[model samples]
Target: MNKPIVAIVGRPNVGKSTLFNALAGQMISIVKDTPGVTRDRIYADIDWLNHQFTLIDTGGIEPDSSDIILSQMREQAQIAIDTADVIIFMTDVKQGLIDADAKVADMLRRSRKPVILVVNKVDNYNKMMADVFEFYNLGIGEPIAISAAQRSGLGDMLDKVTEHFASLKLEAEDDDRPRIAIVGKPNVGKSSIINKLTGESRVIVSNIAGTTRDAIDTDVKWNGREYVFIDTAGLRRKSKVKEEIEKYSIIRTVTAVERADVVVIVIDAIEGVTEQDAKIAGIAHENGKGVIIAVNKWDAIEKNDKTVYEYSNKVRQILSFMPYAEIMFISALTGQRLYKLFDMIDFVIENHSMRVETGILNEIMAEAVAMQQPPSDKGKRLKLFYITQVAVKPPTFVIFVNDKELMHFSYTRYIENKIREAFGFKGTPLRFIIRERKEK
Candidate 1:
């Protein structure tokens, strides 16, 4: 099943951020420089009750006065409604039923999307029960009380959130077409690449109806097989205001990356890779998606013999986490190396889902252990029992060990390198699960 997206929406100071941190257990934030960058909770991958979903926090800007809270709330609510399958509308029990909360509730009610009303900051449930009831009049749904600060009642809130997963009609699991996300900064020829791809005569799939501009994926027919491209760079903003254009770009990028099997991170060849490009590429890597660093507008940059090597080194240095990512200098404008994109895409997709047999995996494990003995502490050596493939698509492996704590990251890195040497899992990140087993 496709992982459903859940977004949190509410007025500022309504405990949205606190609840987001409480739920995600890790904070994801970005700070813009003098050019005015985005700073918010952004998005996180959350797993609750074995149900995995991408949780997006829609409130980035804080509105000071009560008069502007309505408009701000609307902005947050709209983004959530546009992207999320289920939304958690958080309210402050201390604030106690503001007019903006009621108005936003009406707006969400009209969208007809499933929403869970949450009342937060109820440190003492018995005393704050009355304040929680005040939110019921919003008419969205029953208000679930929580104390994000104390980390209480989150399970109930999450249970209500994951309950909606069964109803989510995601792109079917059996759809084998590799989902490639064309993501980059605000410019750098995202739309141009999308235009060129769309101009092709073979893209026969019809546009999806009734989806937000960000939600709809463009289908392209490449090599007689249909390929679904999640074009992040091709979005046309309704608000042309430069300052506000990037506000929701991260939200869209997160949404696109969440659903993508492979991420084509388009970068400006002229500008080379910037910090922002690294940030965007980091998203794909973090999500364990197959990545291809496409240097767009390759025609614009003046080339020398060392130009390609220099550019590749710079990108690798900036995005050092993904050394396995494939790099190609492409011109979406000239359609140079555009067709080759699909071939790389196919290769990476295979590697992303590639698996090895248990016997061979154990053989490699034994060889690796023989080559380098396991790390020891105070004469007690870490014992490696067995290793086997547990899953695919960023192929996950579980390593049974005598003591989980004894397994050092460097040792794990060594094992990963051994696996990579045996089989190239290029363009995809591999995940490992360490489990403790009693040595027989």
Candidate 2:
């Protein structure tokens, strides 16, 4: 689901990162006493009172500074304001109201987006209640006071923040067709593949123009089936992301991954698989989404009969962690072997949501245990009571055992292999949960 976005913006040392950590329930952004410490924007998922929203922490805004680093910080702050659905304009009661504070407030007001004024570092409400009112002169809105260090008055702050999301609906898989995200490094032919697939041969399903926050979700119908394709922003190395727009593109890519049912990790066949390619695959694998490694730009590579075979082997070696993912070779420019990609996407999505019967699962487990007994620890052999399938979409199972400590990682992996061998779980990851069986 695409969650609503809330961005926190203010001058340096106004506790924007502190309030961000408090709301996120973890320390995602670094908190320092020094100014300009946070040069990049940070994002986190926040859930409050049955509402889920994406929270963004931006670098401090110094409008008057023409220095290279401070100007970059101001640009980063502007990106947050442009992308967020709700803007949290924060102020420091300890610092009172300054010219920069009013300047920042005017910026938010001109955005026309819903703004919630926040007053931070109010350790004692009675002593600072009058001080909070001085912020009302900024003309943003009512200032809600809170101490991010002390973690007080956060409930009231969230109450006001979630009010903006009442009309926004979460992204749900209401249809049977699968949602696929095309992700890879910059110039890896991600955009080219989307253009080729949605051309004259394919039927364009939705004409909704995509906005910066929406990530350009394009729908196409293929051979009597339906699929939603999300074209994620191209990802670059941290050092190369010098501009403001480039940094926010990473966040858009993250959001695209979260909303996809299947992810196609595109790799440049000419360059072979890279560290950045492996990192992108890891993100999809960690999310438990069905993955397919699409080796793009095959037309550019000098090829022989054995070229495809050698390239596939190299991809497998680099992404050893994702053995379950299928690999395909194609050229997005000339449209060679692109039809087969649709079939692979369909296959992976079917297996991702597949379910197994309990009788079959137990039969497979019993056979596996009989073939190779689980390892013992000092004569304490593990006893398996039974096993049952618990979830789908990266198919999870729970096995009741006499002792949880006896279940080693290797044995669990062995069991997972057996299940896959019995029921083909192609293009998807499997999870196993071990729990102690209680005596009746």
Candidate 3:
């Protein structure tokens, strides 16, 4: 299901990152005391009492900073506010409601979207309680006070935030198509592949780089299964991109990858793999998205049978950690080996969407632990008692152990490797949670 989006917006250094970390349940954004530390929008999936939503931590909106960078940051935040289903108007109790805050509040009020006013840095009730009342005059709504740095009052604030999303209709229940995104650097033939898959000129194809400026979404059905394809704009280095539109396009591309079930990274067969390609693959791997490396323009490459094999091996060497991702060589212009692309995509999507029964999960866990016992930490044997699939659509599992602290990172990787070997969940990222088992 597509989760509702919540954007956090306020003037410079009002604890937006602190509030973002609290809501995302992780430190995805860098929290610094300096203003404008968060230059781009950081997005994460937030699960609040079983209801999930996408949270966007936007750069602070500074109205007076005529500096180019500050102006760009404000523009990015405005883009997020426009795209969000609900906006969290954050303010600082320490600053005591400045002129910039009022200007931003006016912008949010004109947006007409549900705005949840949050007054951050309220550590002492007596000292900060008076500042919250001043925010009410912003004309948004009742202000919810929170101390993001101390991690207090977030639960109540989230309860109010989710209330705004109560009206969003659930995504269509019966449709089970896996959402796949085609992402890569510029001039990598992303549009050509999408055109071939959809059998139409759905996207403009040009030899020029940075031709597509937004992530375009379309649906296609193959073999009685539906797949939503998102063709994203080519991502360039931060130095190369100077315009505001290109900057937002890059943000949208990253967000699209986070929301996708599988990410198909296209590479130029002639150019081979580059650092930017590795970076894009890393983003997919970190976000737990299924990855596929597509080597486009293969028909143009002067090659023998060994050429394809050698290049594929080089790609695997560069992306060693993501060995599970399948690599394919195809010419998007000539439709060479294009049918195979669909079959491979379908197989990966199935693996990505696979759900293991609880009993089966436990059985696999028992056998895996017995075959290769976890290393002893200080002479204490790690005992894994139970395993459960907490969620699907990439399949996250929680394992209850005797000592959660005793579970080493190497051993966790071992268990993940074993599960993949047994279940054949190729082209999918698996998440494991280690929890301590309570004494009986």
Candidate 4:
């Protein structure tokens, strides 16, 4: 099932990142020294009160200095409307209400997406209750007081946030057919790909429908199987500014990947791989979507026997976080290897939802532990009690242990590699949930 999405929107210095860290249980946006790990924590998978949803930090991008504060805040609110099921419009009691706050609130109210107005930096609710009430003038909704720094009053705020989940159409996009999202940088032949596929003998299942958020969904049948393609192409260059374009590109990809079982990230062969490409690919990696890297405009580039090998190595190095992602060189113009692209998509989708038995998973864990002892710190070695698959759609696993703190990142990675060795979970990222035993 697809999880609901919640977005946080507010001006700078309203404690947006602090609140995001509090809800996510860690400092998620911190830049990691690891090579392939991206610093952009634009979105996170949140499990709160037995409720699962994806939380987006809408302020991840930068605000152009040339633009006024109101314009930037408006852009942020617009993003929340386009991508979120529930919007958390945060304000600072310290800063109080401003003209920008009221205007943004009006925008969110008109969008009709559930908006939860919150006032941050209210460490002393009793003392700051008066100041919090000032936020009611924004005319969005009742302002829930929260001190993200103190981490108090959050339960009340989250309760209000999750209440809207039941009413959201979380399952409205679900169907038996495999859903594929085509994502890439602008002008990477994204539109050409959809055009080529539909221009042929392939049957277009239905009329291209435009969603309320303005996303286009096309249904096509290939080889007697139906697939839904979410295309993030043909964006008008209204901004003209480079940063704003990148910001919008990421937003579109985030929403598209949320509904996809498999994602095809198209790349420009002439431009080769870039940092922006790595960032875009990381979105699919973070969402646990099955990934395939398609190098478009292949016919435009010079090639030799070693050209493919050289190109693949460069992509793997840059996108090292998703080494399992399938790589193929295709030409939307010449239709080179486009059929193989479909074959790879089929293989990836099958592996994406594949599940393994509990007995087999445990056996693999046992053998892996015997091969290399678990890491020990100050004589408290990590003890793995059980490992079992609790869900599919990337095959989530719950690993029970004596102490959660004893589980090291490297050790968890070791276990993950062992699982991969036994069963090839190619093109899909695996999620591991660590639970400590509640012993008396």
Best candidate, TM-score: 1
The regions of model 1 sitting more than 4 angstroms off are 26-41, 65-68, 124-131, 200-213, 233-247
In candidate 3, what are the lDDT values of residues 115-198, reduced to their tens digit?
899899898988778778998999889999989999888898889888977776644667667788888777889988999988
TM-score of each: 0.88, 0.79, 0.77, 0.82
Model 4: how far is 330 from its true place, Å?
A: 0.9
Per-residue lDDT value at 350 in model 1 = 94
Model 2 stretches with alpha carbons more than 4 Å out: 1-12, 16-89, 96-115, 137-140, 163-166, 172-176, 200-214, 234-247, 375-381
Error of 1 at 370 (Å): 3.0
Pick the lDDT winner. 4
In candidate 4, residue 433 scores what lDDT? 93
For candidate 3, the TM-score is 0.77
Clashing pairs in 2: none
Q: After superposition, which runs of candidate 3 have C-alpha atoms over 4 Å from their true positions?
A: 22-41, 47-51, 60-74, 91-112, 119-139, 142-156, 205-211, 233-250, 270-276, 355-373, 383-391, 396-402, 435-440
Ranking by TM-score: 1, 4, 2, 3
User: Cα lDDT of model 2 overall?
Assistant: 0.75
RMSD of each: 4.7, 6.2, 5.3, 4.9
How well is each residue in 28-47 modelled by candidate 4, as lDDT tens digits? 43334223324556677788
Q: Clashing residue pairs, candidate 1?
A: 32-37
lDDT of 2 by residue, 286-384 (tens): 557899999998889898999888888888887877788998989988999998999999899889989999998889989999999988999999888
Candidate 3 versus truth, CA RMSD in Å, comes to 5.3
